[model samples]
Target chain A: MKELIVLSGKGGTGKTTIVAALAALMPDKVMADCDVDAADLHLVLNPQIRESHRFLSGIKAKVDEDACNSCGKCLKACHFKAIRIKRTARIDELACEGCGVCIHICPTKAISAKENDCGAWHISDTSYGRIVHAQLDIGEENSGKLVSLVKMQVRKQAEAQKARYILIDGPPGIGCPVIASLSGTTLALMVTEPTMSGLHDLKRIAGLTAHFKIPFCVCINKYDLNPEISGQIETWCREQHANLLGKIPFDPLVVESLVAGKSISEYDSPASDAISAIWQKLQLAFKE
Target chain B: MQIAIASGKGGTGKTTVAISLALVADKPVRLMDCDVEEPNCHLFLRPDHMESQTMYVTVPEIDLAKCDFCGKCRDICAFKAISVFGKNIMTFPELCHSCMGCFLVCPNEAIKEGKREIGVISQGSINEIETLSGTLRVGEAMSPPLIKKLRDMTSDAMLTIIDAPPGTSCPVIAATKGADFTILVTESTPFGLNDLKLAAKLMEKLGQKFGIVINKAGIGDGSVEKWCAETGYPLLLSIPFDRKLAEAYSNGIPIIKAAPELIPAFKRLLEEVTQ
Candidate 1:
């Protein structure tokens, strides 16, 4: 199966909206939303969850007050500065890296490491196709791990159903979560806008994809908002030899469709026509 | 007071709002761009006399000379950044969280601290306003450490404005944790309201006193304002949707410069928040 992941180095550039549109256009595909931290694809897809699983990754250290000996060894050993010493040592859960170094150094064995339920993932059925998505707990770490888990679930569903394509909606930023979603994907579709921030972020994320030797293609969203910047982006794409798939015009109906909890493809507007054309170009790019 | 401008959704005017506040503040202000992954504040501010310093994080480097491969260091590593097979030991610096567990667990002192360059922190000034920003090296996964370092470098100005990355995760938390107050910027849309609720919950968890600002206000519906009213999170300001402002933003011009009439409004925002 061919795996296509959509990424935007900058936020709110319509990554989820495009992914939902692709889901409406593509057939025999399994979708996965790897933006675990601020997952919004489920808000538009309206999936009926078929399976829910707890995601347990990484550990957090807890101090046993009764067993504490008031020794400050754990305090000095922690590089994260998570331990505070007073009458007894206390650990800051948010600051703790869950490294278990404190557990090893504690003379009285007062510190113990326990796995945290960082989030949950679900396999669900949608009107478009089967999808796998997750929600990371508020202010929780290990989002990269949660993304990898969701991708794993997507692969399993794809293999079982013998699907032809796997569409992934990725998170913003060129961070751990984005990297996890890009690994081993067939092609990366970079969704960007025509703004100074968009061009700046596009360069950074393009550098990241190049560092990993990942082939990628670019598409400009709301291209009409700034035609000059759009021209600049097209020039940059040509100079970098990065494929420019197509551009989507600014459409107020896009937001209207989002408010209605539907993809742009569900509406008869310019943005929907643009996305359909981009899908055709994407399919051809995937085969190369 | 330190004020952080953050939004759960991306491109909702965090950097724009941050730069506007810094420019309009009457007092000496320092703008800290904590969105290390893709910092855009510098593009608009264009600070002069930029000086940069390399930022590094500590990772474990195995000393082959002091080698007794007992696999003890590999066993204690929580991130699995190290592995041992017979006499060969491997270290993946990218995977390392630098928790120092491997160093503490090594029986033979084989593990030594090594530095990996993660990013660069730059300092400069715009007229009277000082600016600091961290630019994470491409492909670097860890941003919180770099963000923390940037936050620590801020000088004691009368006002400090931090521009945070988009999300409700560790990076966002690291940026806004110690701020006196946070301004959550959002558009008046369903997606905006959804992510705003998540960001608001995060602020509550962090015990941060926060208010909201609605950008592109005229385009989307009024769900955000209604929610803020029902939830009692102070609605600070609403920047109406204007093609002129969007064009200025696309051209790397500050919002205040595009709409000079809005300067007094920003000044009032700074006063109201700090008061």
Candidate 2:
């Protein structure tokens, strides 16, 4: 089985839109949204969740007030400033880094460490295939770990269901979650725009894919917004020896399709034709 | 006052709104770009770099002499940055969260705190605004530390506008935390509204007094407006989706520069934020 990840370093650049469109084209693939922090593919795919699992990672320290021995050792030991010397020692839940330093050094053993429920992962069936997606609780840390969990589920679903391809919608920015989404992926399909920010973001993420030694192919979304930058991107793609997939022009119908809860390919517009062509090119590139 | 510009979705014009706000401000402002993974505010501001410094985060180093194969450090670490292979132990510094749990929990006192270079923070200034941005090393796993370091460099200015990273996660928290107020930027689309709710939820959790700036207005439906009306969340500013604005943004020009009429709107945005 092969995994294809759709990544756009800058958000709002049509990564999920492309992923949704591709899911419509390739009905035999398992879909996974690794952008756990701000997952949106499920909104488009309308998956019926078969299973939901709580992602427990990172430990938050809890202090017991009833122990009644406020020696203030935990306050001094905490470097995160999570423990404050109020009327009594209190732990700031937001400030806590989930480090158990205070738990270890507490003279009264008043502090205890507990695993935090960071987020939830879901196994769902969509029109495309078995899908895995996740939602990280607001303000939760360690989304990379949660992303890894979602991918693990996707792999399991693909193996069990015998799906040939795993199309993953990755998160924005070249950070931990993006790395987790890209690791061991068969191909990196990077979607970018025609703006200078788009080019800059593309290069930044391309640098990351290069570091991982993952071969990548670039696609320009809203290529008509600025053809000059689109040309520059093509030149950059050629200079880097990366594959340049076809570009999709800007169209309001694409947004309309998303608002209507349908993929671009399902909606009749110029973009749908462009997307169909993109899929053909993508498939052709994958063969090599 | 510190005003952080944040978005749950990327490319929702967080930097554009931030730059426009700083551009139209009557007085000089400090704009700190806290999106270390992709700090593009400098492109619009064209700031002159004064100095740059490397940022570091703490990671634990194992000392084999005083160590036993008991796996205490590995068990205590929440990030799983350390692992034991029989008598030998390996440390993955990139996966480390710098929680100091391994060093503190080492019964053999075999672990020592070491620093790893994660990224660089730069200090610079445009005409009237000082710009500070952090750039995480391309392959670095952790960005909260670098974002924290960038935000730490904020001096006491009348108005310090922080361009926070996208998404409602640890990095966004690191960037938007401690700000006097946060301006959550979102476009008027399904994806935008979905992510806006998440960002707003984060601000509410952080106890941050925040308002929303509807960017790319008229590009999509009016569901965002209806939601804001229902929730009573203040809609501070709205930048219409204009071909000129989009083109100028693509060319790295501020909206206020591309169209001078937008200055008053941005000024009003500041008034509403500071009011």
Best candidate (score: TM-score): 1
Deviating ranges (above 4 Å) for candidate 1: none
TM-score of chain B of each: 0.98, 0.94
Candidate 2 per-residue lDDT over residues B80-129, each given as its tens digit? 79999799899998878787778877889999878899999888887878
What TM-score does each of the candidates earn?
A: 0.98, 0.96
- Candidate 1 per-residue lDDT, tens place, B216-250, comes to 99877799999989988999999989999999999
Worst 10 residues of 1 chain A by lDDT: A91-100
Which 10-residue window of candidate 2 chain A scores lowest in summed lDDT? A79-88
Candidate 2: DockQ? 0.74
Candidate 1 chain B: worst-modelled 10 consecutive residues by lDDT:
B151-160
DockQ for every prediction shown: 0.86, 0.74
For candidate 1, the per-residue lDDT at B225 reads: 96
Best candidate, DockQ-wise?
Answer: 1
Q: Could you tell me how far off, in angstroms, the CA of residue A71 lies in candidate 2 after the best superposition?
A: 2.8
